[model samples]
Target: MAKTASDSVSLTRQAYALTDDLMTPNAAVYWIDLLVSAALMWGGFLLAATTSSLAIGLVAGLISVLALYRGLSFIHELTHIRDDEAPGFRVGWNVLVGVPLMTPSLMYEGVHNVHHVKDRFGTALDPEYLPLSRYTPLSLAGFLFVALLAPIGVLIRSAVLTPLSFLVPPLRRFVKQRLSALVINPDFVREDMARVRPAWLFQDIACWLWSWAVIAATVAGWLPLRFVLTGLAIFSLATFVNQARTLVAHHWDNDGGKMSLDEQFLDSVNVPPPNLASELWAPVGLRYHALHHLLPKLPYHNLGKAHARLAQALTPDSLYHRASQKGLFEALTALFRRVAVKPVVAEHGRHAAE
Candidate 1:
């Protein structure tokens, strides 16, 4: 008899629990990720300056940029603090840790969870839905264009659409506190915008103030504006790479067919935890994606263990092959061409590489 979905989850969870049910992380690992990322960021900036070359600085900036995402993912896991926890503690932790990384605590918490739901749960209605149609082949030029332009796209998506979404009355009740008071209410402003969460409000203010501080310091000769811009560019590029990576991971071979949440997670490939490459361009939790989707609340350290646990239960042939390190450029080339095509087969939802 074939096992059902519930049986699968139960078995997987049992295996997961057997390894280490301890959900929360050790204090040392937490601080180490934090300190190491920070030190590398500042160190990268210093290295950029000492080299007196924007190219070197650009490389340094990329390292720090990856570090930022790793830090953000860590904070993301932390933001999963249970509702029973003191609201003040949750909010405070989000603001202090999240503000520095420019992660919108309130927004990420909501959207990320939504992003995890099964693709078939909603139609185009799903925010995190990966439309199977995106698998169409693209010219090599178009693929490269998409990959290269990724960072700019992320900035526009996050800095604009995200803040504007607060206009919705229901969403505003949760996100409005993060909006600027001076923001002109659109003609059809919802009345509920008045109730802002103090923590989100303060954090938004802090982010703006921090950006201003950087701009000011750059202008005042405390930090080179070019280096700062390079950092921002690299940060933006990292985000774009993350999106491109996801495109390859999720949409490939998705032929307008339904896939279960667990199936989808199984199909989405994780980039191996990077070494030299990791220092320069962070993987954006790509290494732990399967773990992330499986248990959204677990901090990243547990991701490897989760991946290992799930390894046993997973159908061997189901594992998605990721682009290898040496073939990174080649993978990008093939990915841009949408080489991961699903055959027009007899099965309703199964995918196979062509």
Candidate 2:
């Protein structure tokens, strides 16, 4: 049964009431998880770099992807974290994971929250949204293919664009507004017009120096070229894994229109238990993504507990239950199966008109 507007309101209220106690961000959990993930990622990358055996390198490479993917996923949590709740964690994450990965928190912090806005959710204006189901299957493949190039793209952005932008004020403004954000929507423009922010400026400078150092060291023969290439390969794999996970994150059913809260929740998905692989692919509590949409402020550590609470309280036929998915494959399959040719014709017509 389709959930009525009142039922959505009731569900939203119940969600907040059931998980209000879980709202407090646990700094200890944040620090420990970040540190452990960093260690595993670095350790795995080092092992892969040093190992001679192909099998050992492959295993180590996989570990690096999973570890780094988990660590980088913290960027999402950092955005949702209250300002006073996890003090210094943002800087710590930038230093430990973000800048190193070439995906600093600033790239996502100002951008992601917009995706959750009532009017923006699933709309073309939403930086993180795209109507995938409305497109051809070829578009889906193109999306994944583009994700493969992300590491190389960001490396160039930091190494070349960072210094070049400094020399060109107009370019600086352009970079901050367009290139700085991590968004899926090509047309989304950043609203930031301020001259300076110490936080993002710090990350930009750090990444600039680090990116140049890596390139210079590799070119000057100070860093082994093979090792650098291996690391890039591993990073690319991690990125591709994330892109695959994203393909099933939501239904991508909405056109360019405002949606009610219930409408947005139904469009999103949650791959809870019996889908343990989600723990690795959708790390940092992303498996409960739809639920996260409801409790935006809920810490990642408590997402599972909050999910269980809501599940036990809500009925089987409730919107909460309907939001859940069995696994990633099922969700992706469902999304692609709904694709239509009429949307393709409309899309081409729109492009031709332009």
Candidate 3:
């Protein structure tokens, strides 16, 4: 039999107990992963510079793109974990991935917390969500089309707005509330900025300073224009891949309404039997998104173990099973089919009524 709400609660608690040992973040593993990802990114960039061969450069650039994408994904983990738990992880991420990409941790931290709120997961208030299920095919196309230009948007914010905002306090406030956040909802706005956190201000300034430094170096011929352009291209392509991955991360079915824990889990997605592709696209614990939603406080490193525990504890008919798909392609196809068939089903029902 399918588990009731109470049963789900009991099972969730049990699953949490089973995975308790894995909840703590491992500093050594975290540092090693970050360093390796950095090496792949910069190594590829240097290789691109040394080679005049377009094919070789392209291959190397793609490697950097994948590495940068995975590196940026660590920001998701940063948002969920506490400062004390992973003391220098955030700083390391900011130096390596955040500032260079112009996606500071401040852009995600508080904004992502709202996404996990039980009442806000699928609503307009959820910064990370959009009602993609109701979108027409053309609208969906436009969504992805806009995402392709996200790197340009980030550049404009960092290169143009960041410096200007410092001189103009009002503009700084505007940028802080509107431009600073990394959110998907078009209508969502962050209003709180009266007393900015010291860490956020420092990260913002660091990004601003780095952005100007890069610009100066490139203009002065200290940094090769070719290398700068190559880096920008890699960033753009990586962000595009991230956007594509985001599209299939959820069912995107909920309207502007509150969802229970079960409904929320069902509305989310998980790509099970995690493989190379899943890890590359949804790296650093993203493949277990549904499970993360179930236990938001659980560390990213522990998500896979928690997933296994839950799979063992829950039956096939559980809501958890319904939320998971075999792979990214399958999930995207399911989303597309859901949108495609809705109109046909409605039309058939109208004919039947007539």
Which candidate number maximizes TM-score? 2
List, residue by residue over 1-354, the lDDT tens digit for candidate 1.
443466547644654574467466555566666667667766775676567777886677767666655555554554454644333444544454455445556545444454456753222223343333333344323443454454343334345544555466654443444332211111112233365657656666665556556657888999877676666665556555555444444434454356665456555545544333532333434555555555666656666665566565555543322212322343456554554463332322223221
Better of 1 and 2 by TM-score: 2
Question: What's each prediction's clash count?
Answer: 1, 0, 0
Local distance difference test values of all predictions, in order: 0.49, 0.85, 0.79
Q: Candidate 2: lDDT of 325?
A: 86
Pairs of residues clashing in candidate 2: none
TM per candidate: 0.64, 0.95, 0.92
Flag regions of model 1 displaced more than 4 Å: 1-7, 20-22, 53-59, 81-101, 118-123, 132-195, 216-223, 252-262, 271-285, 309-354
Worst 10 residues of 2 by lDDT: 345-354
**Which sequence of candidate numbers ranks them by lDDT, best first?**
2, 3, 1
Candidate 1 lDDT:
0.49
* Residue-level lDDT tens digits of model 3 in 1-354: 654667657656776777878878887778889889999999998888779899999889888988988888888888888778867989999999898888999898888888998777787677888767777776666666677687788888888998899899999888988887888886667865567799988988888788889889989999999888888788878888887788888887766677677777777778867455888888888888888887887877778777877788777766777767788777777777787765422210111100
- Which candidate has the highest lDDT of all? 2
Write one digit per residue (lDDT tens) for candidate 2, span 58-170: 89889988999999999999888875797888988988999987889889988999998887787667888877777787777778778888999999899999899999999
Error of 2 at 197 (Å): 0.7
